[model samples]
Target chain A: MRWSLLGTAVVLLVVFLMSQRQQIEVSYGQSPSSPDAVVEGEAGELSEATVPSVEAMTAMIDAEPVVRLPGSIARWNERVVREAIGDSDIRILVAPPGLDEAERGRVREVERATITIVGTKVSGGVYEATADAIPEWRAQFASGDVTTLLVPMIRHLQERESPAVDASFRWREPTAAELDTVTAELRANGSHVAEGATLEGVPEASEKAFPDAEALYVALPRQPFGQPVPRYGPALARTFPDRPIVVVYGSWIEYDGPGAADFAELVSAMFYAQFGTRLATYDYPQGNVLNAWLNRVTDVRYAGLFDRPLPYLPFDPVKVTMPALPWLFAACVAGFLALSARSLRRPQAARDSRHYSRLAGLTALAIEVSGLSGERSDPPLTRGIGKLRAATEALESGLPPAQVRTLLDDAENELDDTARLLGRRDYRPRNYLEGRLG
Target chain B: MSASWSVWLVGGVLLAAAGVGSTLVPRLRARGVRRRVAWSTARAAIDSAAVSRDACATRVAEAERLLARAESIAADRGGVLAAEEAARCAERADRLWRAARRG
Candidate 1:
């Protein structure tokens, strides 16, 4: 029985694991064509005439000034560039510090027409990289270009040395028009909006807006400058790691010159990084690929993100059914063991009863023989009966069977003598013979 | 699935395996114990019964021989009634011995 129960449990476990494997395969093994269509559809109708070759985009970037960003942002930018160019040879230059003259020569030797590195110089004890080659790389105030910007404001604040330009004094709350624009965009994208007094209130407001929302959509107030800040994104991400957060920036922010496209690309990448596939219908071609790939991977990881059981927190109670199967299996095993124990005990119990019955039968036999011998009125026979009765009492008192058997043997000898004497017709009592002779 | 859910699933499986092992191990031990006890009891009962049967067989043979001797003695004395009574007693003893052997 236990073996059968174990076999059933093993079968159930195997079936469950196989089903999970199949689900993983179905989700991750799908062809990229359907996603490509979805991506292209999201980008709107594009004519073949308007699509430029990868060579063209690389050439354009090489002619313009280099856009320097942190490694993470750079990687995201490269992905977007690849999506836009489609199989063209392109390379983004990354200039790490402490490169000697020999290493610099090596870099130049490897440099292709597609590569360009932004150089840095020390200014006022702080490292300042030159953005002069590209008009977009120039500081925003100097060029009056809405498209140009500096480092992520949060990183600038965290640095040991201050930047050449300070934008802290320029920080201000969003104007009513700016708020209206952002709120409209979010509403169009199917998000629940909750107004908060400050940036810190975003989480609480989101919670209040839709208590059972699967994801949180936060429309950040515009920065002092048109450029995006690094602090808000990382802060919100840290605060709510369990749920997906979508930070919506106002579309009215302008980007001028070569920096315009770069800034737009950066913003789109930020949205992708924060919310994965839910891009909120942003007007960018790269968003299609980014959203599609993210959708597949995230969907594989989180199988049911937006189903019933609203207010999807990090741990959804509905998805916690995995333990039940194993527990049921364990219960069956336990029950099987219990039955086996009972069965195994049965034979032992029966044996004990047989022992008791045998002992009882022997005692009854001794008592019956003693009663038959008692019919003779002889004193010796009576004495023997008394001895037999005592032995029977001893057996009933838990005496060893061997000792009781010895007592029965002695009693049997006495009974046998009484029977033989009774069989002799000529036998006489001693006292009667003496009286006759006198 | 999230890492927590995966952790929980693996932990649950391990726990169930442990439970099965715990239950099976003790039951197997108990089965061994019961088997040994039953085997010993059966052995003792067989031995005791055989001894009792042998003893009864001897008693039956002795009683038959004694009955023959008593009949001869009674015939020599011309006491037919005494021989008949002695034969009845011997027969009763023989029956009792047979019953004991059966037991």
Candidate 2:
């Protein structure tokens, strides 16, 4: 029974190891950040190394491309770059999401070559600000009626020319009604907007706007100047499954970017905004556009948070799942090895030959004694004697210890019956024997 | 796939194979050895018991039957112990026949 359990445990360990092996292969075998990796999306390949023509990008516009917006030019990983210019022909013109008015001027001055066309296109499915769109963009900037969105790209030319810029955007308080409308729009677009959800990192002034904390509580902390974008904690996301989370960078106040209401409005506005509208609508958790919208947006660039792809953040799978798989597989293999060693060390057989030999001796004596008595004359006794002899012969043959003992016991019973029969026949008194002799 | 990935996959498969080989092969070998030993013992005993079968016609006929059974057991698989027992029974039968003749 114990061996069976051990065998079962080994089998289970092997199964566990196999399961983890697949995950490990996926984790190490194919890196998600490889720029040359061609992922077959519903549209054409999502990871085109060379820039594609304008017509090609336009053809994929209706395919609902999923873009990865890097927090800044410096923070751009291959994954971010691969998603951005995978389909577009134009060169990337990058900047930090949140920038002050002075930094904006510096950015504009640094790139005088394309100053009129400041807003470059994102890769895959973003709006290509063509020669026709460039005039309108300049006109809008001059008019001051709308805040034009900046192009989402890596490698800012301004960073090469001027000193490093910090993330310090303008701040504004939003009304509670606007937050409600934003939440409603998110819900319509298949987002799980937890109403009255306790939002961490909200300023005290905006805390009253969200009074009740009935649902998932998300912490939208400010992203420091050059650090990577903030992602929702895996622990927090696991706690409230299916709750929508925003991977916030800086879409709020000047220091804080936008208020909680403003942040929500920006996220909801991205669903309809020209560049963000092409984002493939994902159900609930997978489709949360808050990260994608906030990673590109900053206060200096996107004064109107709703209209610009430049104002949004980027979100991706948390770092936890990919790294832990290799360790788990290793542990499972170790356990399997331990169990197998234990199983091997145990003895296989414990049958003793001397035990059967002893039983045979006892059985041989019983047969001899039974034959010595005159009980063989009786029909039943004769048959019993024959059976005892046969049993003795069976014992001499190399039966297993248990079966030999059982046969010996049966032979002993027959011998006892033969002895009893002899006792009864020999029960004559001494006096009666003397009288018969006289 | 990366060259390291092939290394890992091959390494894992080899590890699993080694684990199975290390634990299972020795036990299977021991069992085979035990069975062969039992068969050898049974065959020797059966040969020894066959000599006395022609001494007494009635008693020796029973010994012959037991020896036949033992031979059959030894010939087939996994019945070595039983064959040895049957041969021992034939030896006992020979002893009983000699005792009956002396009585």
Candidate 3:
């Protein structure tokens, strides 16, 4: 039993560790083709070394509507349009009202069919147009949702489409209370969003300010074509190794329009997307919004923005719930330990009882031998000796201590009665002899 | 089954087996052997008492009956107390046999 229990415990520990190792392998096994896939260029746009060609980007976008754009402004535009349109089959056409026919034609020629850059008059299957670019397009087609890359317009579109989708799905600028709730949730989930570390000035400032933060959230203002965006991700990662640096680059208007609420959600989505893959690791029951976003925009390449050790996930494992069988086995082990303990205890108790029985048998034999003639002459004497013998046998037969003790007691009484009849007071049983000797 | 689930299931079975096989079976087997040996010893002693011509016929018969009872207990594998009682029965029968032969 001892060996069994020890072996079982050891095996269980090994199995648990093996399972955890497998899970860890599944999570961190994939090595990215390159350690750093994306390198920021002079203007904080993707450098030529990292940026996908227009043809490749177009091909990828055609296959799956998600693409990691070259510039922060472009990604920001993609994020807004993608968020506003959601999982619906609607294609968002990004064309400024200022662009003329020749440029529009070139844009059309480049994109093929996924999203054509068109002038004011928009016509398509199902599409969303910026309110500023297409004022008359909505009047022409009642099937499309119009958004102006602003929170109010996005919120309006959401309100209009809320009935067809989940009513709770609202894409508006989060309030202060909402931001607090999200921040609290993130903290609970072991993600400390360094509040003031927006990387507005330099990466060194954030490193000094939020040294202990697990992740640095940098919301950079969009840089002009000539102006360089402050590349903070690499610098922040160097300052804090194995920590995530989320840099969401957006136009100044995008930041002011959607406000902290949307940025907070996006940051959280990206944070969880990088770190916590299992919902069991979190307190929440629902699926992550970021996972849904990734699934919807299936082909978005994560360009090593956060210095992630593992490649970006296709999607996180939903939830890992332990089976009932393991728990049952654990319970059985506990029960076995208990039974083993009882079994170990039983032998000692039985040995003690056996010792007493032996002494009693030997003592009774002595009394009978000494008074054999009296035992034969007197019927009660003979009967008492016989009863004593019976008691001893019963004791040997593994009766319970209490029952054997009772039988011994009865035998002792019978022997005492016979002793009285024989006018002798020295024939005491083993129990009395024990008490006297002790 | 998933890898983790398989591990758990296999581990659980091993634990249950260890509990039953290591603790329960050996203890029971030891008890059974104890009772059987003790009862056979008692019967042998009673048979020896029956062999002696000077032994009291009534006492010898009574001891033989006691030996039979001990045999029943041994067959039943009554436990530690029953084995002890069987041992005591054997001892008593031996005493009777010796006393009768001495006479």
User: Among these predicted structures, which one has the highest lDDT?
Assistant: 3
Candidate 3 residue runs with Cα over 4 Å from true position: A1-345, A353-379, A400-403, A424-438, B8-103
User: In terms of lDDT, which candidate is stronger, 1 or 2?
Assistant: 1
Q: How high is the CA lDDT of each candidate model?
A: 0.38, 0.38, 0.41
- Give one digit per residue, the lDDT tens place, for model 2 in A130-229: 2123222222211211112222322232222222222222223334564455445434542332343223332222222222332222333332322333
DockQ of candidate 3?
Answer: 0.08
Candidate 3: global Cα-lDDT? 0.41
Per-model clash counts, in order, read 3, 33, 18
The TM-score of the first chain in every model comes to 0.29, 0.25, 0.26
Listed per candidate, the RMSD to the true structure in angstroms reads: 18.2, 20.0, 20.8
Q: Per-residue lDDT tens digits of candidate 2, residues B1-103?
A: 2553443465478456756778678968656655654554454344435433433345646655666666666666564466557557655655555454435
User: Per-residue CA lDDT of candidate 1, range A1-438, in tens?
Assistant: 766776776665665565465333433223222333433333432222221233544454466434232311111232333333344444444333223344334434433423423222111113232323222222221112221122321123234343343322122345556555544644465342335211232332223312334443443332233333432333333444544444433211121122223343444343334432122212222223333433443333234333423223467453466546556555655665575556555342222343344334434433444454433324335434544554555445444455455555544454455555566322222222234334
The docking category that best describes candidate 3 is incorrect
**Candidate number of the best TM-score:** 1
lDDT of 3 at A290: 23
Docking class of 2: incorrect
